[model samples]
Target: MNGPDPSRPCLTPESPPHSRGRSCPPSDQLGNSSSSSATTPATDLDSAVQDNIFAQAPSETSSRPLPIPAANALRHLPSPPLAREACDGGARPSPQRNCCDGRPAACNHRAVSDVCASLPEKSFARHFLTSSGTFPSAAEILKKAAFFNSGNRPHDALLLCNAGLEVYAEDADLWNCKGVTLRALGRLQEALDCCREALRLDPGNTNALNNIGVALKERGELLQAVEHYRASLVANPHQPTCRTNLAVALTDLGTKLKQEKKLQAALVCYTEALTADPTYAPCYYNLGVIHAETDDPHTALQMYREATRLNPSYVEAYNNMGAVCKNLGKLEDAISFYEKALACNANYQMSLSNMAVALTDLGTQQKASEGAK
Candidate 1:
């Protein structure tokens, strides 16, 4: 129980964001949290089974390096933080949310998936001198690398970051981007090292701090990850990614504590996560897990319902709701919930098994009643 939970999707790293093939100050720094404020559609995994949460990467798009702006434009912009990669990179729109509907997640509130941090267009123009020589188009490489990373081409981005470092060896943004790729590749130690290097070069780099937190979180060092997230938030208070990352880490910690039967501590962590980001439905799901474990079926059902409301495609929530309904002797309701679960994910084995059990139980009760009659 002190380790990871068997039935839950482990907390995935919600990476930082960059705009079209360019590093820029985080949108938070530019007072552009609105871009990230859009809701992200939720997907729930059953906590009864452990999945590779950390390895799942969100969708992103390709882009070319935009033109760097003037010095005034560069002054406040920080370097690029971690982002997704793309292949055969060229200009394209941001990653659209195809999960919920035909349109983008940003356009539809219900379809919102976890919207991570992003760089402001204005921030991408930030510039600094390179010791070797000024590569005016160097920032484009980083930007393209980000596009590649978000596009499910981490190896491409990693290679690009390496090539960039060969020329702009002092480029902390390159180092940070490298960390992002390593984390996506499940190279936790290497990713952390990259973040450290980036930090050494640009000690106050927000991207470096967030990337460090990501590596630690992926490594299952929940407390350390929490601290790093706190540091990232302190450095950039308005950063939605930082806040969301912290919430995830705390929820992970709570899950671990819950497994250990440390209910009170687990409750506290879950509460903290909710406080950090109320819109995060996973936190609610985790809370329901706690309540159900404690025999608070009514409250657990409420939480599960809330999770499904927030994320209509939350397969695990439906499965859990079915379980809770069965526990309460609501056999028909349990079957309904289980059917909903199967609707979301036909191959969800737990829901299949739960449905079978509920049906058998109902049959048994029916037989007994007939005999009594």
Candidate 2:
């Protein structure tokens, strides 16, 4: 399943989680196999529709992730603990890996030294991918969970994430990953809880902002969703995914306003959508529709062109463009645009009907010319 396409809206179901606890593809394997763990490329899945179908792919993970595997795999740490430590003093049980250096030998370095000297080995190694280590590292577990989340197995992903959170409760990325998995599972409230926890740990996390926004949008909380999306953009103005999401949300809001006859407010939303993401195709389409309704054929045609430029397969945009051209007395151009619409989506009835009309008009004009000659 591909990640969210910035060109579309949020939480669009990418791949159906028809099953859970499924094994991930070997391609998603993380960490090197030998002495050190290898890197597993994270898949940033879209919670919405499938990628190839081209509707709204999913909400953005990172502004960088336009779709699948959008941003750098959620904050990966080196597995197998980078360093081995033998605590001389501090606490009885060392929190560093498997080092069980009892409390700082009576609170003195000498006591700690005495204990280390008495140990059979000066250092210990915990292998992440091997049975030699009693347990997997938090990073490794999270990485595995990411793969599961990407592969349409939210159930397996949730299990791994919940397990990791228990051990690494303060990990922000871990919380973010868990949030994504929960969102994918349709556990909206639980997913929001995870994202809120992630935000508490890192208020500046754009990923969390986007994730929470997706959850909110899915729950019909448009204003809150807009708030999260707007916050994310403020945090990282350079993020394209966030910008795309904002545009999507605005477009939705605008559509609703248009239905309410709030034309001015709808215009503002459509315009703001473009401000958020200039290349957002739907925004252009909306603008075109508005301009056309206002009897501004030329401006409407321009907007439709912009939409088609951004999304070549935009059949509706093409159909609208034909209508605008026809209104402007460009019968040939109208026919061409209608044909383009049909080419993109052969079964589009609107384009087919428009094309027929355009052809009829062209035939009538030709007959008139012959009669005049």
lDDT of 1 by residue, 66-184 (tens): 11110000000001111111111111122321212233212222211111112122332221112224332335556656655544566665666665565556666666667766766
Candidate 1 regions exceeding 4 Å error are 1-134, 148-160, 184-187, 363-373
What lDDT does model 2 reach? 0.51
Instruction: State the TM-score for model 1.
Output: 0.60
lDDT of 2 by residue, 149-242 (tens): 5455666666655655555566665677677666555566987898788777667666677667756655556578779878977876765555
Per-prediction TM-score to the true structure, in the order listed: 0.60, 0.66
Cα lDDT over the full model 1:
0.51
Model 2 weakest lDDT span, ten residues long: 76-85
RMSD of each: 17.7, 15.8
